[model samples]
Target chain A: MPKLWNETIEEHRRAVRDTVLETTAELVAEQGLRGVTMSRIAERSGIGRATLYKYFPDVESIMAAWHERQIAGHLDELADLRGRSDTPGARLAAVLERYAFIQQQRHGHGAELSALLHRGGHAAHAEQHLRHFVRGLLAEGVQAGEVRDDVTPDELTGYCLHALAGAGELPSKAAVRRLVAVTLTGLRPQG
Target chain B: MPKLWNETIEEHRRAVRDTVLETTAELVAEQGLRGVTMSRIAERSGIGRATLYKYFPDVESIMAAWHERQIAGHLDELADLRGRSDTPGARLAAVLERYAFIQQQRHGHGAELSALLHRGGHAAHAEQHLRHFVRGLLAEGVQAGEVRDDVTPDELTGYCLHALAGAGELPSKAAVRRLVAVTLTGLRPQG
Candidate 1:
């Protein structure tokens, strides 16, 4: 893998990008979203501002890229849950356990994500990938009779997000799971 | 009513306070959180700046008052649901329906709310009240057997907010309702 010069060059670039994102992530998490900026990120990353700008045009792009990275990680972790033999209930619990850690990351690993979301950029790839991944999961649950067949996965995913956001209250992992249970069992239409 | 007015000047001040808040709410709803400042509010309400300042020292105060007023409304609406004979599932549906509207308020109502949440001081009231309203509801749901009884309402509410803000897929109310249903059901206990 290291023998190819182009591949080696690409690896170095990726390493630099990861370092910059990791530093920015920590700053955002520790200080909250408002403190993040290209200058600050570059300074923290130990790279010159010019060098950093070459990689990222602006602070928003940096945040956007960081968010995509985090989402990718989350998706990868949940990838196998779709095939798990557990009922939809168990599957959701397992997913929430994973998500809860991600959520807890707000004070650290999640800082950049939270900042980016608040900053408000809707990149197309991230949006489509998230929707498609969730849609696939709900479809699996329905086929298994572990989750209700009537409602679409998109709806389910949205509700989980808002409820987790605590539209009415803050949501815990347990709260998320219980809500899923009622949804899979209670909200399903009767024949 | 005329006779009552002579004895209830306090009520009149409260009424005026609400009108001032409504003015800010309307403007912010139309413009954005940035659009709301002492001067804009005073001019829009046709109340002098001094008078507006007399009621609310800054945008934060105005926001807190607005949120508190809304909290009063939410409590009133959900009061009957609390400990009522309705299934936890039904009660959660009721809550999400209300939240769908709350989110819509963001296109306008959210700017000021955002301003308030991000800042501290009198703005702290809004955040506190907002959190309180959410936790109170989760507590109710926990008792209803619709939400998992094991978790704290605060953790649930916090995670939900982070998730709602993170979910990049949702755009409309119909979508929000479906997502909310999925989330609420997920929170139900495993048994």
Candidate 2:
């Protein structure tokens, strides 16, 4: 095939895949994980069942793909925050605040979906990447004398992540910010 | 009936119920939650199946009763620590250390059982009591000027609980203690 023809075909396939994933997410959000079906996803995405099947084997595979995309997006957002031109403390605060909000937003996905998506290799891989990403930021903060050096950066990362996870149960964005503030205080140097 | 005979019958019933709860916990520890059954619990406790049924409808009720007892015991242990004659900071450290250890020990119970027992009224009530108990300690620390007063005791309690929950995933008791130390540091007055 000609190069232009090949490029057009690849772009079309990518667009179709994105549509299927987004449509499935909307369906799940509207009707719950149990209510979603492959046929419904196909109809909603405006793709034939045959084309949808070519992209995903079933509803579970589609949901997994969607979750993977969401995790990737979150990681990228945190990275962007880390890359901002500011004091290390300011960047760290921004990342922690955003992470807490993400944790709070995750509560809307429901426990059943969480249990399903939290299992398997993808979630574990994402967790490792997230830990490494946060640890790097903490190391930067420590070198700048903004974060405490008494604890290892790895342990501090664990502390921050576990502490902010409570944001999921918090009542509001302001409460999540308060939780983040308390967590940040824990990372400060001792007197 | 005579009062003496009535007292003896009540004592016997209490003994039977205690045996059933303990035996069910042992069974779950040895063979996972799904392996436990009403017959197995009755047999292990050396009680008739009919008598066991009179006490608990099935394995789930038995487990629920055991979890409730465990939660109550933990709260009492923390309360005892809080009541000890020491500085407020010392008492808070002791309670937090014990709480972290308890959270670590809970990891042995398996996720299935945790899910089952964490739902419904008992877990929520225990959580409320725990928050109140921890908040009281924080208030005492604040009064002594040992703990930070910038944040409310209620928020600090939430922070401490959520942070120490990571102890469940820590590799050792030493690590759990380290987690507790970090959390306590966060509670200290800022310079």
TM-score of each: 0.66, 0.91
The top-ranked prediction according to DockQ is 2
TM-score of chain A, all candidates:
0.70, 0.95
Task: Give the local distance difference test score of model 1.
Answer: 0.62
Write model 1 residue lDDT over B80-142, tens digit each, in one string: 554563665565557545554555544444443665654545445654665676677777778
Estimate, for each residue in B66-179, the C-alpha lDDT of model 2 and write its tens digit.
999999999999999888848989989999999999999998887788999987589899999999999999999999999998888988898999999988888888888888
Looking at candidate 1 chain A, the ten consecutive residues that score lowest on lDDT are: A162-171
Q: Which residue segments of model 2 deviate by more than 4 Å?
A: A1-3, A86-88, B1-3
Q: Model 2: what TM-score?
A: 0.91
